[model samples]
Target: MTETMREVEAGATRELRRYAPLAANDNREDYSLRFAAVSFRRWRPFVVATAALGGIAYLADFAIGASIVLSFGFTSGVLAILAAALVIFLTGIPIAAACARSGVDMDLLTRGAGFGYLGSTLTSLVYGSFTVIFFSLEGAIMAQALEMALHLPLWLGYLVSTLIVLPFAMYGMGAIAKMQTWTQPLWIAGLILPFVVIAVREPGRFAEFASFAGTDGTHGSFSAVGFGFGMGVALSLIGQIGEQADYLRFMPPKTAENKRAWWTAVIAAGPGWVVLGAAKQIGGAFLAFCALGVVGAAHAVEPIAPYVEAVRPALGPMAIALSALFVVISQIKINTTNAYSGSLSFANFFSRVLHRHPGRVWYVLVNCGIALALMEFGAFGFLNKILGFYSNVGIAWIGALVAHLVIVKPLGLAPPYIEFKRAYLPSINPVGFGSMVIASVVSIVAFFGAFGQTAAAFSPLLALVIAMVLVPLFAYLTKGRYYLKRPNTVAGPDVPAALLAGTHECLACGEHYELPDIADCPAHSGAICSLCCTLETTCGTACQEPGAEPVSLGMPTMKLS
Candidate 1:
């Protein structure tokens, strides 16, 4: 070989060495919260359903909804919540499908969509923010329940609430699935008993509730400004779909026989998360109405206290005690999810940013730490406006994600399925990433009254709209090059037996995957599990088998019409 050719080869070898770890996994930690080789995916459909029910973890859904009602009255609160639910349902479908079909996390999907290898760091902040911020909120609710029923000190309650989660989380999904399944009946009973007793005792109160004016003193009339304001807050839950997707990834392999169950689980857990969420929101509004009159308007929106009161009419003092239990259990159901997904986001953040693969558990604790810090700083008092405003940015990110997954990919403007192996994808795809940034900027501007009070009030929704339109526009103009770098040839292929031997270990996380699920990772110079593929960072998009796909290199394309 010529001297220059030898130098080029040497450089190529060095680059390969840097990324060689991408193909391997650290079996030492076993994919963090993941269930490495477990076959629990084979369980009955009911388990999946119950697990999906766990999506009802956040207390803010109810609190936020109640505040909307208390601020805007029934018409605005109810209507705004319903509207937000509809939007969330539509957006969550494609995102959930990508998770189940590809069996990768949201971070991986974002990487392939348009954010280059390093570009996804922006999303990492958004997702991690969602996790930690919500964790503090949920943990605070847990503390409130403790203070109300058990009379525990607020600070201690916070400590208990936060620490209780560590044991369950460290065990990962095997522990979570079992815990969720076993607790479903108790959780259901706790959630319903208050309503059941309320109906028995306060049949006349609900009629009174319909006409109850909010703290804002807005009487029974349509207020466009209030409606817009309420929606700005309600729309923040759109990214809760990420939490749903986290669990949905474990859906067992779909086949013709279990097709019905699989689709039900996917839909129920995916978009259907909002249905239950909407119910909680409405119930929260109602409960706030019930309490606000008695507790003063400021305390009216607190669902836990009113819920305890309603249960007391029939269940007696036992209800207060039960309220305490309800708070802790519900928080556990949701916070595990919050912490779990948070950890995943941080893993994505640090892995992509620093080119290091810490165990997912480490990031989990890190996420929780940030949340606890926020709690100590008194974030709970400002939860309503805080969630409302943050929703704008959250919606922008997820909105772009959903747009690419549903709108762009289906029209042949982007890739058909998620390409997340890092080897086959570009370091950045501009379609999803650029659109999200633009959407966030515009929505944030609108939020700040730049476009008038009405527009500023409902900026989150605006962001969502902007991302939906811009992602497709960018995809069309860029010819979908932003999605991947090398053409995708790994998935939907005949597998080599040696690769799937069920014993082939990945070099990064150092674990073995079923041969069928394992793929050769040129980035790491070894086989890699799908999860590790997402967690890898050093590999540039060089595993496309040489022109097998148009990933991120800005190559010219040939039309296939």
Candidate 2:
């Protein structure tokens, strides 16, 4: 090579090396990688799974149930909850299994499933937005509780609830897991006490609640249109499975001895969250009915009023204190997951688009700041409209993703294993990207009443149906050719397969990474980590030929020993 060309190559290699270990020593805990491959002894699968499942204990279920019941009658509200649960559970099973088995986060899984490299960036944005929206929601609920108990202003409570999660979320999964586990028992006790006391002390209330008519004059009757709209609102929560997968990715590798426990953890912590959530929603509806007389129908939809009423007969004046405590604890648990997961999503997104790694901690702050802003702007007041619109996009994204994982891969139309590495994937895959876009646009138009009230009520269902159908159709049309750009050529005898089993040091920055996070970079002439690969903008496809095999650069391979 000429002297000028040689100088350019040297400069590029140095830049590549500098990007490799951007956050090497940082306490990622469980922020970025799918399978961090930390010692199983340090975090048992069962414990981690329990912590993950416990995040679902937030009181938003109560508010959702009450809102639906007040809008629709009890029967229609119950049916909607059941319908949403069934869809969430069915869709969640395959996603949970795929994520746990492959040890990849949702964004990584999206890339491999069908979206391809840059195609999944939109999904990262969608998923990240979910976190902020829900974080604001849960924070708003806590703020309401604060207003009731301590006579604090709602605005200041919003700030308190939003900021409280920062210190814990910054530590990542380890801190989150411990907090969830520690607080779970108290939360469960607080949750059940009011219900048990109410039922035992007042059996006649059940009859009254069941007979109560909603404000819409449904008189305990079911409305198909109302049921569909309620289901759409509930279905907006389907993206929560992505948060479950965030923790499931850290599950200990399934083994022969602990296979049963592993499956139990995966099921309970995964789709099983919806089962409990559905029951909680029903309970909330019941509580709202009982409190309708006390709080008046206008304020009945708020969880604080119902919860305070439920325990008032038992705890008397202490009811607000206990209720506020429960709300604060519950919101803290779930919001931490929200903040942590949002940071990871933002990291994946900007790392790819901006070609830089500023550490997941920075994104944690950004996600929280956005959520706090949303809360300050009164997101809670427009809960229905916001979630109703967001549900279409969330369902479309998950529908296409689940179909790719469950149907296309099984039918052999696409690669069975997820191909997440940058080198092995294309920049875009038409199946996932095209399907999501078409589904979102069509459903959104219908949601705005272009197709009448009935069609608008069922917009989420339309998005789900369209995306699911299109993914398989597109897979067949493309013959799955775009799934992988090339086979993974990073693994070989030179790099002991055992090294791939645990952590391996990147040849570029000499930073350690779990197997899933590293890939061979012919441009750098070594094993490059994913963050490093993402930050490299000038490699110019030096890693592979157009259609043939990956060309090796004869660089010395790093030995694990």
Candidate 3:
């Protein structure tokens, strides 16, 4: 080989090494920007489901429940919580099923479902924002516990809470699964203890909670406006399905032997998260009510204070210490997830936008760093305002995605199966992306009270409805031509045993990837893994054009004879 050509090959090898699979580094990356290969999906369905379930162990539900009841009273708050949960559950179903079946993360699913390959980057930011915002909220809760138990400054507590989860989150799913599984028992015990103590020591408090007027002094009875506003706040959590799918993508392929377990795990870990989430919110409302007189309304919404007060009767002096430990444990379980999923979202966003990916571990620091900054600024203080505003945008994105998956695809308006590869997709697809934009703009206007108070209160509901209608409308208008730029040339029934069990060698990275992760690259005249395809800037999306010339990676295109 010529010396200059050898130098170019070496440089290319180093560049490819940067995006190589985690096995090259002796730590599995859990496939941040690529398809979850069948060979790497070693966890059983139930185990994967349990790990996904563990991410919801945050104390945010307590605060959300307490805030809603305080603002809307018991009648409106409880009803609103249920209403939001119902919406979240229904929307979560199709997303969860698609991710599990296709072994793709939420971002990849968005690319194929409605948002085109490039258009889904917008949702990546939306999903990424959800993680950082919640990470800050959860970290603030842990900081409060630190201040109460250890006498640490809130700033120091924020740093501790942020830094503590980095090691666990840095390793991805393998470490996360173990941490979640080991901590599951303790977290569950801590979750139930305060409620159990209140039930026994103050039985009447539960019954009296129903009649209590809110601190707002006007929502003593159910008000439609109050319910709508409260539901909007609750609906902010709709983006959490993204976090759930990050884990569900790792579920072992469903088979005849494990079909029951597979379906059960998917449902329970997917939409069923909201079941426990709703119950925790109600529990938070009840606990806040019990502690209202002791801690005052301002402090009642903080989970640490209310939980400490609730268990004080049972454990006497030890309540403070145990509750602090519980808070710390709960925060760790969730913040790790926030950091982990946030890194995935960030990785996906930057990889597509920059055509470069440093690694998933580096982005964990970036995610936690952003969360720490939010905590230092007192994110906990304005929890309702932040969540309420975020709901309109979040619901629009999720609703459009769910519509494409459930409605457009089923009605034969769009593709029958998910196509996530950039090689076979255009830079933008109007079906999902257009719907989300229209819905978000309309709902955001409503949220600002442009229409009326009632409209402002129910803005997120408007976003969901509009997005659902627009997906099919846009699909029909465009004739679904925008969904795929090219037909599958590598992994389909036309190729025997396609994507079932074997691996293909990627020409750019020179690494073997499972069939699902491999695509025939017109630019390279060989198979390329999804990550390599995503990181290739020089190809100029040639695969999407008919009879396009082979474009090399920063070198002249060489046609192999």
Candidate 4:
């Protein structure tokens, strides 16, 4: 035993230069690539949910809502919005639960859900793109508000908008949660004020809005083609659940005592976000209808223009200032989340590719920098075009994730719990990765009109169907062998209470981690933390070799000083 202990001590720490940033934990880097430690999961269910839900404050919903309604007319647009909302809500349920219960972010969850280690790097790219794209979109909205209210040049406003969110996001969840909580009341009030004013001041506008023919001259009649196209646009927001999971992973372990609150928070802040999102879309359509005569269809889709018009009756001369303020507040609340989650996604991607993790904070610059560039090039000008196309890829990725979590896992075709540790997972799992790729390729081809106009209009829906079908098909065909490279019987059961019950000292980092984040390692000759497992390069996966002692499956036997 003494000789074995000495050998373990001499095995080398092998800490990555990049992991220093995460080790600092000053900003609660909060285990960006590993399980969110139970020790740090201190927030109440409601608080975490609030922080997650707060990320949806971006006015892009308004833009998306108005654009679809204006292009497709009232009936088709409204039906499409409701339909997309239902899809997002239902899919969000299992995903949100899995992430929260596993204490891992979307990227980690993806790895365990059948994408394997390197396979999920693609998803990291997909999710990171979602953040950057939306960051640019939300930043553009705020920039417009700045330009409108203060005459700031669009370029300068973009710069200002980009700079403003850095301080809040740099500090990660602690700072972000407080900011989101503090601003929630004001945002809610501002959100509803314009609609209330419209209702009271112009009671007949609602009736008029219902029958408005739209810019396409559909005469307000429902068109199947228009509805399909509109639904595709709305489905782009499916990626928003990933941002929610980033926060939801920090949820405290659900207990019998907090069960009701836990479920409520998970549902409301998790999948239930689309409920409010759908309402906001409808409200945006209403506001766009109210402003159509004043601003014309071109400017009506810009959220600031319709918002200013909607509140003009109530606020009079102050409408512009208040509307600008609301826009700024709303954008800040969401853009911080975008930058924050983007950093997480990028950090996960590069860490695996480069085998180094400089930390989550540095990637905030990468995320925001990319977004700022996008704004400069006018990504917002192609709002519908960009979102419409992105919806296909986004839905395909999300659809595969949801199908694995909700269907295959329940049906015993995949692991019952998440297995995210790199030491124990294969480099790639074809189940999810292959499904997402095939679905994305096929749907994108359809989106580009290769499959006819109607197919092009509904490409994203096609992606969803293909991905959902493929997850179970691939899982069964692979016989669930690829889900985990090795079984994990170490520490304890994967339940929240069991995972949070004890701590193990990671031999590589000399830090204690909860059971869920620590794994046995033959290469290190001791138990190692997941982050250390991810960054270690010299091991060459000796732990996973045939008859290699199966270190990750059983508890570590080495004594810890």
Candidate 3 Cα lDDT to native:
0.88
Q: If ranked by lDDT, best first, what sequence of candidates would result?
A: 3, 4, 2, 1
Candidate 2 per-residue lDDT, tens place, 1-561, comes to 001112244455343254323244355535384345544325677887987887797787888888887888877888999999999999999899888877788999999888989999999999999999999989999999999999989889999998899888888777788899899999999889878988899988877666656876754777888898999989988999999998888787788998999899999999999999999888998998888878987678778888999998899888889889989999999999999899989989988888777678778889999999999998988877888899999999999999998889889998767777777789999999889999999999999999999999999999999999999999999999989877665543245555455555665555666655667677756667776667667886666556555545333334443
For candidate 1, lDDT tens digit of each residue in 74-188? 8777888888899889888888877765555677667766676667788888888988888888888888888888788878877788888876666666677788888878888
TM-score of each: 0.86, 0.92, 0.94, 0.94
Candidate 4 residue lDDT tens string, 467-490: 999999999998989988777656
Ranking by TM-score: 4, 3, 2, 1
> In terms of TM-score, how similar is model 1 to the real structure?
0.86
| Candidate achieving higher lDDT, 1 or 4 | 4
Clash totals for all candidate models: 26, 0, 0, 0
Residue 352, model 1: Cα distance from true site in angstroms: 1.6
In model 4, which runs have C-alpha deviations exceeding 4 angstroms?
1-18, 21-23, 491-500, 552-561
lDDT of 1 at 519: 49
